[model samples]
Target: MDHQGVPSDALDPASPDPAQWPVGRLLSSAARRVERDWNAHLATWDLNHASHAVLAHLLRSPMSQRELATASSVTEQTMSRVLTRMERSGYVTRAPHDDDRRRHVITITDAGRSAFFVASDRELAASMVTRGLTPEQAEQLRRLLVVVAGERGPEDDPDLSAGSAG
Candidate 1:
């Protein structure tokens, strides 16, 4: 089948012909598109999608660097660098942990929150790329993506239940 054409169920994992799998390719292409749109949307703010993600995670509540790393799915070193840049930009503040002075709790500043709101709006607008799909089709796509990622949506993130900034 052509890349623009709908794939058949025979190409699914249930089929024996693993070589014909198109799911991976489709997802990769979609991810690239998302990244491209994200970068373009964030360019106005002089920030990248990764920085926006980190800020979004912090908007929920202050977290240790380690927690931010896990929540952002970024390495600790990467998180540190992002935090340093954010701090220098006056977007975030680091307060010494009450229990452990050696560890600092990172919190989003007013500027950070404002920037986050802008970034969130940009992201929502970019998601309109799927507006052409019907509601049911959107749900089906989401379900299929969830299945492929082997995740249970927000249910998989315990922090989601805590009602943090996000």
Candidate 2:
């Protein structure tokens, strides 16, 4: 293994030869690839993964930049940059909070929701990670990933407890 703990033979990040890597490395590599592919898929819509998340969250509810960063799992600095671009693109609008002049609330525009759905449709069709998995296998994979990420399952959420499809 190299100093970075990557197998010397697997130095090529573009290669799909993770057969010999350790479990952690394999998982990380797979995640990186998935993120890259997802970003590429969103490129046509002039959106990146971070921006997409921000837009989606704003679509759900208006939020401050700090709230968006936390919800999007990004740093406030990163969210600020993303918001700037989004505002410039007219995908969102930032307005001073009525009660809090120091805080700015973000709202998704109609165009943002339209773009989000369009990109979402294409994303579902182009996602390569689940290409050949059966429904059961996909669910298993999702559960395992959720565990690895240390996140609660939908079953744990009160809103999802009413016999909603998993």
Q: For each of the candidates, give the backbone clash count.
A: 2, 0
Candidate 2, after superposition: displacement of residue 160 in Å?
Answer: 20
Residue 151, model 2, lDDT = 72
Looking at candidate 2, the ten consecutive residues that score lowest on lDDT are 157-166
Residue-wise C-alpha lDDT for candidate 1, range 24-91, written one tens digit per residue: 76577668887887778876776777788888888788999999999988899999998998888788
Best lDDT among the predictions, by candidate number = 2
- How far residue 134's Cα lies from its native spot in candidate 1, in Å, is 4.3
Candidate 1 Cα outliers beyond 4 Å, as residue runs:
1-21, 126-135, 150-166
After TM-score superposition, the amount by which residue 112's alpha carbon in candidate 2 deviates from its true location, in angstroms, is: 0.5
